[model samples]
Target chain A: MKSREKEISKIEEVLIRFHRRHETFQAPPFWTERLMARVRGEKMRGNGFYRAGAVVWRFASVTCLAAVLLALYASGLNVETPYEIVELMFDDPAGLDLALLFASL
Target chain B: MAHSDKETQDFEIIARIMGGDVNAFELLVERYRPLIFGIVMKHVPYDRVEDVAQESFLEIFRSLGSYAAKSPFSHWLSKITVRCCYDFWRQHRNNPEQVLSSLTEDSQQWVDTMLAGRSRDAFEREASGREAREILNHAMARLSAEDRMVLTLVHLDGRSVREASDLLGWSQISVKVRAHRSRGKLRKVISGLLDGRQESI
Candidate 1:
């Protein structure tokens, strides 16, 4: 068993040496240039996405504000109270008083 | 530059990158190219070193937002580099051609010399040859990617489990378990080769 352990240790030593012998290689002369080009391309693509998102956000904000203003206009903002709003919404355009509409309430 | 100065500069460059100055990134690539290449070469095949190194740098750039300055930038860079190598192996794991190369006769002779009860000096000299490397690679190819990486880091490269865990982003216990298991697997591969040789004789 001892001899077997010794043999295994020797094998492990050789394996360690295999790793230690890793060769030192210089980066290719054009490696940095190529890498930088890829990075630039990635940044450009990211910027494109950011710009698209900004445009969409601006459009959505404007559309939302416009919708809210339209809704307020349609709802008769000139009316001052809940009763006035109800009268404004239900009164006939020909000038019916709408008193019957609220009498049950 | 001093280590602290380099760290400070790395932060400065990262700030510029975040602030929309893409050209500033080239400075970082130039500064760390050697370090990145060295790490990749140790863990990746020679032919794939450039591709893997490129992937690592791209990942570093993409992940810069998450780099919280909690540790030295080189340690973070190392973690990325090692992970990239691990990824390369993982991707290649299914390709039988990458894993199925039989041990050559020359490597078999080298293995024989290792077990021939030779002197330590003789063993060292023999282990430095190309055949020794071939044998090691062949044995490693048979193991899974995780096993191969853990064995390489802990057994062959002489890194502690803590160091391996940090580089691999694995829990310490996970690294320890994989390291022990992979070492046993490696031993089995070599012993199987020896037994086959003995049987033939």
Candidate 2:
């Protein structure tokens, strides 16, 4: 059994060496152009999806920013506290009453 | 090109591609096509080499946004290319039509000559024949895709366990264990062949 293992190991090394001696292949002529055309086609297909996604993201971001800026502008941007900003953004009547009470205090 | 300069250029090209100049990708493909082909050729069937390499490059381009640049670009590229070859084998692993090439008489002679303990130089000279490739491929076909990848990376490619693990995204222990088992499997396959040839005599 031990001798068998040794023989296998020897053969494995030889075989690996043999395998390594195989010449490295060069890319066939004009293969890069063929590959590039495929890449460009794939990117074109992908860009449609990406462009739609970008539009959605841009719209969401602009709407959010515009809403925030409009609120700050309408409230005079002088609402110093986060509580005031939240009050401007939401209709929590009880919280509004609490803020009024705090202001009076 | 200097190594650092090449890396800088690769990063510059990657940045340009990410910045919406997709045409900049041609530079990268041109630079690494040889490296990618060399790797893919070793891992995939000869006929599928171009297909697999093309797929690898597309994958690299798609995932360019995720590259963090901590590791060298070439190492990352190698990992992706190797993974593409692995995927190729995985996809084909279940095909019923996958046939092992028969070992030829010349391959049998090559094996006999190898086992007969000729000098190292003589062995090296004769081992480059097409028969040796056929015999190796015959045995390698029996291994699972994972085992085949590990054996090729470690045994045939002469990569260390650490390097193989990095390239394979496998734990070192897994790579080490798989390498040993795959080698044993290969040995058994070859041994069976040798025994069969002897019985036929």
Clashes of each: 0, 0
Docking class of 2: acceptable
List, residue by residue over B1-201, the lDDT tens digit for candidate 2.
Answer: 345988999989999888878889999998988889889988988888988998999999888888988888988999999999999999989888888767778777777777788897887876776777788889988999999999999989999999999998999999999999998899898888777667766
- Inter-residue clash pairs, candidate 1: none
- C-alpha RMSD for every candidate: 7.6, 6.6
lDDT of 2 by residue, A2-102 (tens): 76667667767777887676567767788878878887888888889899999999899888976665564546647777787676658654556445534
For model 1, the interface Cα RMSD in angstroms equals: 1.7
Candidate 1 C-alpha lDDT tens digits along B1-201: 345887999999999999999889888888888889888887877788999999999999888878988888988998998999999999998986774668777776776787887887887788788877776777888888899889888888889999999999899999999999999988887777777667766
Provide the DockQ value for model 1: 0.46
- The residue-level lDDT of candidate 1 at B32 comes to 89
The DockQ leader among the candidates is 1
DockQ metric, candidate 2: 0.43
C-alpha lDDT of residue A99 in model 2? 55
Candidate 2 local accuracy as lDDT?
0.84
**DockQ category of candidate 1:** acceptable
Residue B119, model 1, lDDT: 81
